[model samples]
Every structure is written in C-alpha cells, then in structure tokens.
Target chain A: AQRVTQPEKLLSVFKGAPVELKCNYSYSGSPELFWYVQYSRQRLQLLLRHISRESIKGFTADLNKGETSFHLKKPFAQEEDSAMYYCALSGSLGGGSNYKLTFGKGTLLTVNP
Target chain B: GAGVSQTPSNKVTEKGKYVELRCDPISGHTALYWYRQSLGQGPEFLIYFQGTGAADDSGLPNDRFFAVRPEGSVSTLKIQRTERGDSAVYLCASSLGRSYNEQFFGPGTRLTVL
Candidate 1:
C-alpha cells in the first residue's frame, strides 16, 4: 500500500529563517508527490507538486527517489506562512483512479514574527 | 469560475441520526472525490467518482456510508446511524480529467455528532 509519513507534528521558525518540512513515502511504483496548505478558515489547496518542479509562494520540494522523500523547503519564512501543511502521494493507475491521494499526518508550521 | 462547493457548511446532529452532505464540482470537472478530515490529521479519502460512476469506493469505512452523483455534477454523501466518531469536516474536490491532475477543494462541511 502507498503511505506517506510527515515526521513533524509542529514546526516553529522565526521570520526570515529557513524552514523545512520532512516527508517520506513508501510506494512501489513511480509516485507523484504534492504539498498542500490550509490556512485558518481556508480550504486546503495545492502548494506544489514534484512533477511540476515549479515553486509556489516561495516554497519548493525536491523528489528524491533513492530516499523516497519529498521535503518542502523555503528560504525565508514569513509570518503569513503559518499554516498546516500536508504531504500527499497519488498512485499511478493510468486514469481517473490517479486522483485518489493518500495524505500524511499534517505538520503545523508557525512562523513567529 | 466558481470552485468546488459544499453545502451545509456546518451540521450538528445527534447520534443515530442520519445526515446528508452535498458537493458541487467545478462546471467541467469529470472527476470528483470525497474525503474526511478529523482534528489534527490529514484528510482521508472516502470515495471518488468518474463522471457519474463511482470508480473507487474502497475508502469508505462501512456500508452505512454511501454516496451518489446522479447528475455527474453534484454528489451527496449519506451517513446512517451516525456516531460521535463520525464528527469531522467532510471535504470535496474535483479535477479536470484526473490523470495526475491538480484537484480544487471545497470549503468543506463540518459535521458534529452529539
């Protein structure tokens, strides 16, 4: 079964400091990874995906096949960046089934000003 | 364009009662999904629909949990004999054609069982 693990339950960083949220997955096939963010009173939304290789809101995640990790990183943390982050993995079943995403226990990030 | 929308933003019900949560996907999205989010945890996949057919219902916890997308645009999740454990925010999402497509989420319906 495909599984995602986010080790940290909570992470605190000062404004302007670098931050990293760890994520590891166990999947046999080539997996697509994603990072989702949910701010207070807001819906959970996509932040970045491994396949896109594009940064969003100054956040980036690199997919490491050898380590089976897709860790989200940001060079500078802003106070507004405080939110809950979830790491997710989608199994490749070739069609609409690919939309089924298995998510990890989210990590709460608090950027202190 | 309007994103995915869910009705009854908040619902409070007593145990053993029945409840229905609704979701309206994006106008052209062909795939829709339902997920349940408990406190302090990531959302758990419940079921998914491709057009009007249920492509995956394996994530559903039990037979008491049922869903339908009769018109292929709006979906309803019905739960019977609700228990306190069922109290959580139910989320809905939809994507264009589903092959690794990005999904847009709804605001979610918070269900509380008393």
Candidate 2:
C-alpha cells in the first residue's frame, strides 16, 4: 500500500519570506507525485506535479528519489499564496490500484503581512 | 469550458434516511472520482470511474455506500441508511483519462446528518 505523510499541520511565514511545504511518500514501485492547493472558498486545484517539472505561481517542487520527498518551495511568499496544500501520491498498476491517489493530511499555510 | 460540478452544495438529512449526491464531470473527461473530506483532513478516495464502469471502489467505507456512472458523464453516489458518521464534504473530480493527469475538483457538497 502507498502512503503520504505531511508532518506539518500548519505553516506561517511573513510576506517576502521563503517558504517550503514538506511531503514524503512510501511506495514500492514508481510513483507519481502531485501538489494540490485549496484557497479560501475555492475548489481544490493542481498546483504542480513532479512530471511537469515546472513552476506555478513561483512555486516549484523537486522529486527526490533517495529522500522519497517532493517538497514545494517558493523563494518569496505572497499573501495570495496562503492556502491549504495537500501532497498526493498516485499508486501505480503494480500497487493493486493505479487510478486513485493517496493524500497526506494537508498543511495550512498562512502568509502574514 | 467548465470544471467539475457537484449538486446540493449543502445537504442535511436525518439518520436512517437515504441520500444521493450528484457529480457532473467536465465534458469529454473519461475519468471521474468521488472523495470524502472531513474537517481539517485531506480528501479520501471513495470510488473512481473510468468511462462508464467503476474501476475502483475499494475506498468506500461500507456496503451502504454505492455509486454509478451509467452514462459516463454524470455520476451519483447513493448512501443507504445514512448515519451521522457519514456526514462530511463529498468532493467530485474529473480528469482527461485514468492516468496520472491532474484531476479537476468541484467545490464539494457538505453533507450534514442529524
């Protein structure tokens, strides 16, 4: 079985400060990782994926195989960046199910002015 | 053009009653998913549909919980003899396919059982 762990339940930072949301996963086979965000009163949406290797809203995440981690990072945090973030791992075919995602508990980010 | 949509943004029902939550996936999306989210927790997978068939329902809590996607566009989640423990935000999402693509989500339906 695949599992995701997000140790931090909440993170607070000042505007313009660097921010990082840590995520770790345990999977036997090749896994797909993704970060999703849910702003206040908004639906959950994709923030970034390891496969894309692209930054969204100045946020970027690097997949580390040795660490089994995909930590989302932003050099300078903005007020608009405050939201709930969830780290997810996609179970592959070899894991018994490939369609569903195993998600971490989530971390609430607060960017103070 | 639109994202995934769920009906009855809020639902309140009594225990032992039956309830059905609806989900309208994005047009042309072949994969749809249902998840349950409790307060302060990330969403938990309940079921997944690839086209018109249920590819997975392992996450479902019990036999009282069932879902169907006959037409493949819209799906319904049926809960028999709803219990207070079943109250939570039911989220619906859809993706282009059953692969690792990003899944678009709806605002979710907040179900409250009394």
Q: Write the per-residue lDDT of candidate 2 for residues A8-44, one digit (tens) a residue.
A: 9999999999999999999989899999999999999
In terms of docking quality, how is candidate 1 classified? medium
Name the TM-score of chain A in model 2.
Answer: 0.95
What's model 2's lDDT at A93? Answer: 62
Say which candidate scores most in DockQ: 1
Segments of candidate 2 deviating more than 4 angstroms: A94-97
B15-86: candidate 2 lDDT, tens digit per residue: 999999999999999999999999878899999999999988999999999999999899999999999999
- Model 2 pairs in collision: none
Compared with the true structure, what per-residue lDDT tens digits does model 1 show for residues B2-111?
88999999999999999999999999999999999998889999999999999989999999999999989999999999999999999999999778789999999999
What fraction of correct interface contacts does each candidate retain?
0.86, 0.77
Count of backbone collisions in candidate 1:
0
- List the pairs of residues colliding in candidate 1: none
